[model samples]
Target: MATRYTADEIVERLRSEIKDRRPLFMPNCGMGLSGKLQEKGGSDLICVSPTSWWRLRGQGSLAAFLPFSDINELVFEMAREITATVDEVPLISLSGPHNPLLGHREHLKRLWEAGISGINPFISKIYDESFCEQISNIDMGWENEVEIVKVANEMNMFSFAYAFNPEEAEILTEAGADVIASHCGATRGGLKGAKTGLSLEEAAELSQEIFDAAKKVNEDVILFAHGGPIEGPKEVEYIFQHTNAHGFTGGSAAERIPIEESIYNVTKEYKNVPME
Candidate 1:
């Protein structure tokens, strides 16, 4: 892909999106959905992680299934793949607690030089419960995330901080995260009996708290909400009305859930066709 905008340019565009009050929907996608999302007028903010990227490329789950010992290698490979696939859209790399950036500054610089627009150091307890437990010996806390944001700021790169509540949002914003995302856990895709986080109303309320905390420090910081029950247009509209969030960072809500429902309905309808 041809290089278009610099990292600072991407950050400026994100700020512009907030100033305009137009909530940009950043759908986490790979080659399959990025083009379609662009055609439909989604935000230039595109997110991709090793787990999701591998799944998108038809490689199944991340390290759970694949034999990968080094996460840094995985991140580089994922960035390369996304770099080759995406054109103009700004790519955001979602790094977990295991990534080298948490410890090594040079690793963070490498991520920026690899054509990545931004970095989201996300360690979702609910989404990665098993992985977290597996790495219980290793310390992966909020301080590391703050350090990642600080490093990104030092490099003039955008940092999308994943925060579960208002307190986390405040700390991340104070740490110079360009975007403070209020996130719950990943929503269960097409599952009838599965656990989820707060309801949409609760998510909006939490977002308002996060907004207040973030505004206490930097009013220009881009705020967004994700996961939990905030999916679809009505939910998104509710969050914007109730909270100060400028948009949402959609993951499974943008990809798996819709595809599951659509494919099932389409296949069921075809299966029930009458024969002559």
Candidate 2:
């Protein structure tokens, strides 16, 4: 039988563990599991992909990517490694394959069996039906605001924000998203004139809009802003206060610094929201 974890149980475990040991804020640190993340952040580091979105999540420094056939096996191995190094277990979030709905629901079932804290689905332009198809059983994915509300409230998970869309913020707030995130600093920007890299300023400004919109809908909805070029602790604080996101998650912001040093500085200012 599939191991079913209530949202509350997941939340409680995550909260308790993090409260004991600070949660590792993993981001687009590298291709496939990064040793840097493990070396500094420890086992709590989540490994995610798409090089665009769902960047902050982690699932330990994977020796090999999470293969659907034996995802649980991978998780067990990673858990062992993390525990060995960190000396304790912390919740890890995996950035799943492009679409959770891609394979049969069995994939999700296996993932659940692996005992992951969360899985973030990648893919742009997701609709309700297509979105529902991806996260049939899983709680979160790359969903729109309408879908975010449905997933957050019904499934009891969190989700991403529509890229720079203020309107979508309203939808996410209603969905019960504990933290609102975005991929403003991902790798795949269309490369316009000068092939400009992803901009955290754009992300920050947009996050402010999302924050204002969500507040208009409901003030309690906490925001979790992300992207690259955050620069320093002051920038993190600026974005957090400006965008109204209670937390911020983006590695490139401090890619230059030692990973642990960066996190110590960043999390000292902000925190994270639970996502799947």
Candidate 3:
């Protein structure tokens, strides 16, 4: 059976865990990746989305290329898959403002009823509509993004903001984001032109800024870092030591990049092995 947690209860649990210094290692995942991560002791949070789900299931090329309307069913299907495949770890839906379904409160309520524990309404600031043709039509303004977060909070879903800078971070917190993630652009091996946003050094410097801004509004909000310079446990530890963020969150880094390398290496080596 699926476990239900209110936004406040989820935040309280996350806060207590962070207070104990048990840093969160949330990785974006779907069915296949969730199963692998779960077998390896699991993540503190698992981010579920159409993109990652499709990618992990061998339809990755279609993930970024598909539109929100086209992929919404896949997203919901993946959510049900996670409910069956993963246990304990909070499943946060990584949605966007362009999402046709999540733009309304009733749909958000339906999502919660379907067993999703949280929502991460990620708004891409740098890309224009033309630029995002490969991704979805994520043309939501800051106010639109904030309103989504507000509705998610109103629904009592654990709301997370995927902010790339301190300013966005501040706005999201004020708009009622329970968790604010400094989501730098994707790193090497992710989508084309993925290496954008703050450098690791710059992100470390901005962490305090994000933390201060968030704390000013919601003192109990959780801060996390994603993508860019952060990869693996060492980088995660470095971010924790250098920044005010409590944990690290990964998507391609935790799912695609490593999987690509491992699968490629293993398959290549098998070619060298005797097939006869």
lDDT of 3 by residue, 1-276 (tens): 346678888888787788887887677776744644653664667777766766675644335544634444565777776777665667777665655445558657766777777777745454565654544435444556678788877778888787766677778988789888876666444432155566678767766677777787778788888776776677777788888788787776777777777888899998899867
TM-score of 1: 0.81
Who is ahead in lDDT, 1 or 2?
A: 1
Clashing residue pair totals per candidate (backbone < 3 A): 0, 7, 1
Residue pairs in clash, model 2: 46-58, 46-59, 47-58, 47-59, 101-134, 149-175, 223-245
Model 2 agreement with the true structure over 1-276: per-residue lDDT tens digits: 112344455445445544574432444333323533444554323433322121223222222232423333344345343333332222333334433353424434454444433444332333345755665446444453245235434644433333346676676666655445654543221111012254656767877877788778766554556554564567677776556555555544424234445566688666654455
Off by over 4 Å in 2: 1-6, 9-108, 123-153, 157-163, 187-202, 254-276
Measured against the true structure, the TM-scores of the candidates, in listed sequence, are 0.81, 0.52, 0.84
TM-score of 3: 0.84
Which is better, 1 or 3, measured by lDDT?
A: 3
**What ordering of candidates by TM-score runs from best to worst?**
3, 1, 2
Backbone clashes counted, model 3: 1
Candidate 3: minimum summed lDDT over ten consecutive residues — where? 187-196
RMSD of 2: 11.5
Model 1, range 180-273, lDDT digits (tens) per residue?
Answer: 8887665544432135667778878877888788878897787788877876777888888888778788766666556667888999999999
lDDT of each: 0.68, 0.44, 0.69
Best by TM-score: 3
lDDT of 2 at 136: 48
Pairs of residues clashing in candidate 1? none
Worst 10 residues of 2 by lDDT: 187-196
